[model samples]
Target chain A: MDAREDRGQQDISGIYRMYSKEVYQYLYHFIGSREAAEDLTQEVFVRVIKSLHRFEERSSMRTWILHIAKHVAIDEYRKKRLQTIFAGTLLKLLPSTEGLPEKELQDKEERTHFEKALLQLKPKYRNVIVLRGIREYTVKETAEILGCTEAKVKVDFHRAMKMVKEVALHIYEKGAGVNEIS
Target chain B: MKFPSDEEVLQEFRNRPDAVPRSEFLHTLERKLVEVEQQHRSRSKMRRTTIRLGLSAAVLLAVFFLAPIFTRLITHPESIMTTKPEAPLVLKGQQLKLAEVSPAVKQTLEKLFNLVPELKTMEPKVIGKEDGVYEIVFYQKEQGKEQRYVSVEMVAATGKISNYENEKAMNEEAPSPTEEEAKQMSAAFLQALLGDEFKQYQVSQNANNDWSSVAYTRYENGLPVFLDRYYVGVNSKGVTYVNTPEGAQPPVSSEAFPKPGTFLSEEEVIAKVASLIELTYSLEKDTGKPLLTYSLETTGYFHAETGEDVESVSSHTSRYSDVISVKPGGKKLAARDADEVAKVMAEEFGIDMNGVSFEADERILPDKKGVEGTLYKSSGGTEKIMVYTNNKELTGFQIRGKIETASSTQHDNKPANAKLTYEEAKEKAVQFLEPYLDSSVKELKIDESQIMMPTSTAYSFSFFALHDGVVVTDQNYLVNVDGQTGQIVNFMDNFMKPIGPFPDLDTAISREEAVKQFLQSHPVELGYILPVEKETLQLRPLPVYSVDTRAYFLLDAISGKLVK
Candidate 1:
């Protein structure tokens, strides 16, 4: 009810309005599961509200928020990996993509292959690809988000792209029947 | 079948169908945010209330006891006259009660009460004499919600209040003062307490604390002494707590201070600093890939009389290596292969290398690049190093431990005699590094050298690993030679292998421009000028600038971007 508290509430609401959608989309592509991404998105905003005062102006507000989102998604991935091992039988009870219509099955399979290849890449490589290639962040912006030198970002992006190309080619060779869109 | 291009693969990945969340997700998230904020505010309020209640109980207990004392003093005014004693009290042998405080201490307490009359109702208690200083504690309740205990230290020698501490429950809802405001408040409070002596102290704002506390150091003439300093802490509730350490006395005279004109010229100092600059590399935090950087750090101060810079502590020799002596376990053995080196190292350092594998054929030391020695590296490239000559003779041994992540370590610089001359130290250093020298090296140039007089006298000599004629910027060998014994105390050869082709230095910016850029980025700040040695008295007052070496960077010659 105090003026300061009221101002803090306003700030949090403003930040949510500006960044909630972008953060949610970033987490969605990162985690590859809509439900998990939504949960992690909520967690990221909670952290953002708590740590907003500590934000430095060295990086843009969007870069800072996405940095927080990246950490939240990574932590969730680690937790889910542990859960998948412990409750493998319970996970099997969840709905399968195989039950979809034949037309939707091909599209689902291709999408699943792309997600699998991304998940298989190392976290460092995946981070560069997601930030620079998928999200289309500039080299300088990617460097700020990754907390590295710009030269290092460029080098990593080059290597990450090469790896992605090799992985996609191998997947196509495996008879997935996917068209060469390029 | 031809593989898809990188661009094609990237486009396919980027164009993948988006995974949209449910429509109600945002509304749910907003509701959750409000709930979380409310819970946080409630917990914070509860914590403040609990502290307030505890403080109020302590103050009430003090008031209950002090009420009777106040009434007794009012009834018999003669009691106050009788309690005052003129004679100086010596507390060397007799057991003194809390009530029987020294007259000097009582005078100090009275003076403080005169300045802040509201504290008189608290009935201050003399705790005891500690380190020739009397401690007094005063308790009081405020607004039925907050209680405060103000403790003051009265020095026996000077009768000056040396320290003050106020313990109270702070109001969490109160707005914290800005850094600039806290600094101004601290300076004003110090001036009010010390009077004319405040002119001798320089206020330095602390960088780390959220409370924005400020520290004041006493400068004699112009030179700030390391001994006398005061710290001021201002809480969110606007309560100021001042702490002045004992042994702080005003300077006797400013006539004998040395003028800045007699010191080294600015150009000479810059040249000396530039000569000490060295290029180094650090691994990127995310990728663990090495990135080039430059460093010019010194743990030294400029000498007052001689005008020469004196290193307080000896420079560390190793770059990525930490050396530890490994015992032979009473067996004299020759280190022929990697296994022999590993065996000797493990036994000496008492390290378990049971499952650890090492390369026996590859004669490369991890710390020293291009140094052909029998090398043994652990799995993570962090642990284990042993050096031997080409003939497989064990010359030097080292154990690389965990990487030091801490920025800097504070080392107390105790003075020592520099027995050996610069020529003698250089000779010892070169002789120590002679085994690692290759035939390609045309000259062993002593690029930088310093004689450090810490607890132990040692000379640090940096030799550029030159090939043909030009200096190999990345390859430099450092050696520390003991002053007394003429022995090599430490050695580090940082010649990274697979050196890339030398870049064209023609397009590089001029040295003058580089200096201009560096000065523009890092403005000089006035720092405390302390004596080079603790035993040396009457240090000349000279204005000195402290450059934060961590913030210093070398601009790329061509791009003008930070190299490190």
Candidate 2:
């Protein structure tokens, strides 16, 4: 209705071009599956667009974008947790690379023990490792995204790392690949 | 199974593949945003008009009068508005409903509808957007059969049309344009869509696609860039689909591209490697027959600047070997001795024979001296390291794991969670190999250029042996570090321990005579080939004029006669 709004409009594409990659990288390590990460990354940007007008100058755009992404990841984890009743135990028996294409299978093949060990972590630990360990975000930034204090972020991240080693040893002892030890 | 430090685990996480979002994913999101922008604009306009009218009754009256225009829009859309796909894109707390196409997006839609009148009845809607570029989908189900459609993706900012597809024309068995007529129509469509930008590209002669499709290559520096070609598919119903490539390439200034005279021509390059071919015989696989053919061989690339063959990349590092001060013991040892070799292996190489058995196996080809097969566990075990020697002088040794087959994709080659970088893996390889080195052999030099690459896993270090700093070329060791565990899972040495004093390498005949004699038997055959350099992950696309004598060996340095 206003000419000023028409003359110099800010659209979602600009926001997407700037922040989509950062959100995708953050979500990818969190979810462990690229397909799910892609879907959730799109969902994050969609939420960003709908709330673009509501954005305040209080937080850096990067922080605001990732804050939205954290919610999407946690929500996805919750959904997967519910699906775990059927998709959980059965998925462990079958090889994850069973029917993937050669290139995709090769790519999945190289994901370090961290992904396999990360799967063994609870959502709380997974979030900490994904942000602090994989993405290498600062404690303050992690705290900001997680909506927790910096001290809590540091404590949780330390505890989460200990669990990774424990799980890694368990997987190695079980002779199941770190990739498959649920 | 030892897990690495937390830093290593974190590095592995960072190294995870497919970390970036797919370009197609970005494109899809761009479209969604475009639809949203249009909707927001429309909803705001609707709200403004409803408030000005001052009543729900007035809004109903406005809808009744606009009904006729809406009816016409559904048929031919002389005037039309775009909307969101799926459910009404209304949000809670926002209280927004209905959206008008943003001004720029509406202009793009109207332009496309005008360009292709058939698009009006097809319910054209912008389904995607990026940076003001709107991707619109238009279609109407064929009266009875499954729905077939067309899409017009318009770049509103640049007015560049990506593709205009018509599944109705493609799927239906209607009359179609001939290959030549299709080419003309394809060119016409590009000109119509791109306007002045159409002059920048020309029709490609390399049209390998089916008759219905035509290709055009963009020109830079007055020469066609075949790599930047685009294809347009046309049929009787105008254009069906244009294969438009996505993503923007970094802009290269005109000066960065070489002018015509700067690079060697294909003909000039091929001339550099051309030599008289000698008649040879090649076996036919199907008939189990030999067919006579002319052959000459060398591997190289035609340098763009010189118009000459630049030899293909190989292990250029000086081999590691004994210093010149050390002299060979005596005459060469022809007879094989198992006990002495085992003694040398145990002492010099640090191999333990307390629980291992040595069986002499001469079945291995090439090496005149038979191999000393050292099997682990005495009785038997899969973990074994075989040692080879020309008499007391050790030639080479190789390590084999239980399931380390070449084709095996298990933990054999996959980088274990240990997370070893190239430098770290190399350190582990050197540590595993330190115990095996001896006095006669000079220090090992890893072919840094040919380290872990393309393989993704397994740091295969080819440590060439040198004598007085000169690469023996023939004498080298291979140590493959397990990509996963950083463990030295494979080791092989092709260094033949010199049993006798070295011979002077002077040939009986001169270089010219040697070449003449060699050409008399196997003449030179020169042709262009893509000499794939294994040092990098991607193959160089440039084809070089070089000889491929992969199956043929060169003349013997001593006798000056062809070896193969």
Candidate 3:
């Protein structure tokens, strides 16, 4: 490694210290847990490092970093999906509810409802909704980060939101909570 | 109702964009790039060297000569080029393991401290990243039966109990035990702390072949006892339980424990009442003149020689309109009505109630007629009760009386008394804090000075000091003990260090200036009207700002209640 590489490394390190927290916050909203967020953030940077040489000054450095972030996030989503499938089957086989029969039944019902709504979202729509709703990303910034136009981001975000709302309304119509027919 | 338009939502998004890194994210990418480059360089170097030296032969020779060296390098980096790997750390002198804990030890812990039932499988968590030392944790229910967790840290490297902490001991009143009960509890706690020794006296065996020990000691009451029990071991590294005796040796310290006292005083009680009243009023803000009713409660009575109404009332309140029938220092009891009074007599006097046995005292203060006192005395103890009259009869005229009027009128017979000044009050509070004050505490700081009162000045003092590896701040309380009659009228101490500090609002020329100054350059926006004034001891108010996507800021000023 030469001084020029070292200099380049310094510049990259400087950028990381500044944005690590913001990026971590984004991952935390989607994943939860400080430890997981840090791991994801590190993975995001690893990918960013791999792709840094390929980065042409086509987009601003911020937009480029976010593009890598979007890919990393998608990868995390895939990994989580596989994990969820495994947990779902294993949980199903477990003695339905652990202890305190009445309370466990109620908790399981609520948890199932929540998981159903979360799973209903399409991957593309889920990405937008999670970024917009959970990670608290702005439509314009999310679009920029996702490499889509702002208007496209908005349309997709609304469509995803509509999907969530529809699921909720259907649950209500079906009477899931109290006073509703099971 | 229509949901937000896509455009409107997008606008909100643009304004408060998600918590994505703006520019600093590139640094992580850069570091990774460097790491990848280093890895590539190393791989190429290995490849070139292998090709030059004939890969197969060189690889075999290197492996034969350097395998131990490589392992040493990885495990003991400092010793790689210097010396052979040292022997594995051997914990000696009273070292014990979970498999070794006796049934006697387990029984003692269970009986004494009511530890969580999952004691057998529990493992200690290592504290520091570098150190392999571990600590054991146990939990018990505290006041209100709230679960409080305690940790007994064992230094694994040394096989020593590093520390023991009763997590909620600082906040809640300690449970009182009889001399014998206290001794038993202490013995059990010590046994749990000293894992292996406590386990050795087990008389019983379990299905898994695990056994318990029973060590006997004379009860603190010096009663003759005959019982043997088994103790259970905590874990692999058992140094955390240092206080346990090796055999049946008893504890040396039989020092009489001081009785616990309530955290609240007269002013604190009033403050608590006021806070509760304010909350009730806020909830029913729309209702005009809503009558707020709550229960007045009391607990902990001091035993009197006469044994009538218990003496030295530990705590009292006027929220309930109960008759004080009897006082016995122990479990809290209240009499709200005639039936309650009858129940109290039936329970306390050991005689069946003949309907209601007592009547409410209706003594209105002569100076302040709105305030009424209801004092009751039995052959055992005397109980004092005060009631506030909300009706406009106290100040003689209908002058839309303030809450202060009610307080002033209530204690007319309790004359004005001189006590500690602000400085003196702080001194006294610190003096009272001798046992709990951490060694690092430099001095007490008067966080709050003057408090307005209708009859006397109420003051607040906050004491702070950094001690015992952490900062210590607690409400140091003091009040005027009436010189003539020694009745505590007012008290205050809501002092802890402010969370951080609010930036100087004046230094900034514009709204952006204030936000940037305090929040370190995060986005800013106009926050909603906050009702609570920032306390002097509080850190800066939450920076209500737009980060381009989220409309969020801290809600509570004291702890920085971010809306997230």
Candidate number of the best TM-score: 1
DockQ of each two-chain model: 0.10, 0.15, 0.03
| Candidate 1, pairs of clashing residues | B327-B348
What is the Å distance of residue A30 in model 2 from its true position?
30
- Residue-level lDDT of model 3, residues A32-146, one tens digit each, is 3334555678877666554554343234455567667767766876777522442244234223444424533553344344334434455567567656655455665676577
- The predicted structure with the larger TM-score, 2 or 3, is 2
The worst-scoring run of ten residues by lDDT in candidate 2 chain A lies at: A2-11
lDDT of 2 by residue, B164-214 (tens): 556667777756565556767887877665554455565642212234566
Tell me how far the alpha carbon of residue A40 in candidate 1 is from the true structure, in angstroms, after superposition: 21
Overall local distance difference test of candidate 2: 0.51
Which digits, one per residue and each the tens of the lDDT, describe model 3 over residues B345-411?
4563233333213332222212212223222211111221122112221111010111121133233
Q: Chain A of candidate 2 scores what in TM-score?
A: 0.75
Candidate number of the best DockQ: 2
The runs of at least 3 residues in candidate 1 whose Cα sits more than 4 Å from the true structure, single-residue gaps closed, are A1-182, B1-174, B178-188, B199-211, B214-231, B239-396, B399-433, B438-494, B504-508, B524-539, B543-550
lDDT of each: 0.53, 0.51, 0.35
User: Which is better, 2 or 3, measured by DockQ?
Assistant: 2
User: Which candidate number maximizes lDDT?
Assistant: 1
Please report, as a residue range, the 10-residue window in candidate 1 chain B with the lowest summed lDDT.
Answer: B404-413
**TM-score of candidate 3 chain B vs. the reference:** 0.17
